[model samples]
Target: MPLILFNKPFQVLCQFTPQEGRESLADYLSIPGIYPAGRLDADSEGLMLLTDDGKLQHKIAHPDHKEAKTYLVQVDGAIDAAALARLQAPLDLGDFVTKPSKAVRIAEPDWLWPRNPPIRERADKPTSWVAITLEEGKNRQVRRMTAAVGFPTLRLVRSSIGPFSLATHPLMPGDFIEVPANAIHK
Candidate 1:
């Protein structure tokens, strides 16, 4: 099985196909017969897994499998204990209620790379960092969750999926490495 770990940069579409004047995965990767196991939106920067194995792809991407994905978020306001509690509890998202998730305030990671078009800054307001681990990957779920809690996310980065993580195998944007398929078992 060919398993690839890719660091997706901001503004790149998650698909391999060409889009109208926007960059896609095809611009960064030309490997044939492999597709993204899960998608990260064009606005979110993060780690993405791609593979040729259909079964493995389904197992990784399907919400029923409950694969844990960790994200480092920069929100617009200074996070507080009450906000963290609400994030950890089951909160209604209007369309659907989210499952209880792991959320904690964290210091901004020192190793994070600067985004090309930096997030807007306001001198009057403050921004804080949070680490959130979710079992399901709903569309724009992280952004919605933060916004619901009164801390709109300014920047988002997926730091890990299941057993693989950028903390252990750091890759720059648009860079990729084929890891052993068996590494997923650990």
Candidate 2:
């Protein structure tokens, strides 16, 4: 079983196919026959898992499996306790209601790498960090949730998916590590 852990950079598409004027996984991944288990929008960055095994891919990506994915998010303004409560509550995203998730303010992770073309700095409003862990992978869910709660997400980074974490692998942007399929334990 070929399982790869990739550190996806901001603005890089999740798929391997080349996109016009945009970077794709192919730009960083040269391995053949592997596909992303879940997608991270081009604007988001961090842990991405790829595999050749169809079963493992589905297990990792399918919402029904309820595999938790953790994110480190930077919001435009300071987040208050009320905002945290709203975020923790089930959120209706119009399309679907998100399952209850854990959201709490956390110090900026010291191990995080600075994103390229760094997130725009606003002198008027101070930014704060939050850790959000969700079991479902919705389209730009973290960004949407933060905005809905009145603090727009300025930067989003997925730090872990289930038991697989960027910290364990310590991969830099565009770097990857192949591991045995059994290495990931729920």
Candidate 3:
């Protein structure tokens, strides 16, 4: 079977196994044997790939592959040039130093769905959207990066992984479609 492009919703666990009071992939996916190639935290949302092929899974999940993962982030405060520069520069995250990433201010995505609980907005503080691309995955990296720079991430969505993108294969939350593994590498 080919890989699956899943639009993972916020608060959904990456694994298929049941968790106490947490929604898992098994709740949405009935297909057997397929598993997520990479993880997206329950607090985050967007495109994720599931496959049964071990080689393809490794290619997608391995840090050595340096697959570009893109995120649409909504932050608690307006991001200034300095913050953008910090985001684009190598970040020291205590345990590891992150590679330089692409960070740019972006207008709110019109195509995005309204997050179920919605991000909390402060009446006095302004919020901004940023498009950030990371070459490597880290535990809560984007959230930590933004907070480290003084602007905490309020909402995060993974819009792409490697060559696969939500734009190329549009899926609403909880929807998925099958695609050839070769298409992901192309």
Candidate 4:
């Protein structure tokens, strides 16, 4: 079976199992047996890969693979050079220390679609975007990392995972397409 690349929207849960008052993968996907290779929190948006193959799913999700996942993070404040440097280096998040990552300030992506419920904006505050790529994704790591650096994440979007990317395969929210399962290995 091929892999399914989906553009997950904000506030959609990352499971097939139904939950009260929350939309799950089942809502957008009726493809039987397919499971998400990795999870994006309900509050997060963008690229997700689903596969029916158990081994492939595990290979992408497991920390051992150190599959690179990149996020476009919209955060509070100007997101100066100091914060960018701090993000690139590992900062103890209390529960666990993170590995060094690639973090750089970027202009808001031209291709980005707005969130259904747009992020909060304060009259005196300006938000900045940062492209952060990490090999190991711990739970809510990007959100936690930004908050630790004094610029809390207002919007979190996964732009790519491993060799697959929204840039290479652009899809609007709730849209999906099947690609060769071996695409990621190339």
Candidate 1's C-alpha lDDT? 0.93
Q: How does candidate 3 fare on TM-score?
A: 0.97
Tens digits of lDDT, candidate 2, 1-186 = 799999999999999888899999999988888999999999999999999999999988887885799999999999999999999999888888888999999999889999998999979999999999999878889999999999999999999988888877798899999988987652
Q: What is the TM-score of each candidate against the true structure?
A: 0.98, 0.97, 0.97, 0.98
Clashing pairs in 1: none
The candidate 2 region of ten consecutive residues with least summed lDDT is 177-186
**Candidate 3 regions off by >4 Å?**
none
Model 1 lDDT-worst window of ten: 177-186
Each candidate's number of clashing pairs is: 0, 0, 0, 0
* Candidate 4 C-alpha lDDT tens digits along 58-171: 889998875799999999999999999999998999999999999999999999998988888799999999999999998999999999999999999999999989987889
Score each candidate by Cα lDDT.
0.93, 0.91, 0.92, 0.93
Model 3, range 41-119, lDDT digits (tens) per residue? 9999999999999898998899888689999999988899999999999989899888999999999998899999988
Give every collision pair in model 4: none
Give the Cα error of residue 100 in candidate 4, in Å: 0.3
Candidate 4 minimal-lDDT segment of 10 residues: 58-67
Give the C-alpha lDDT of model 4.
Answer: 0.93
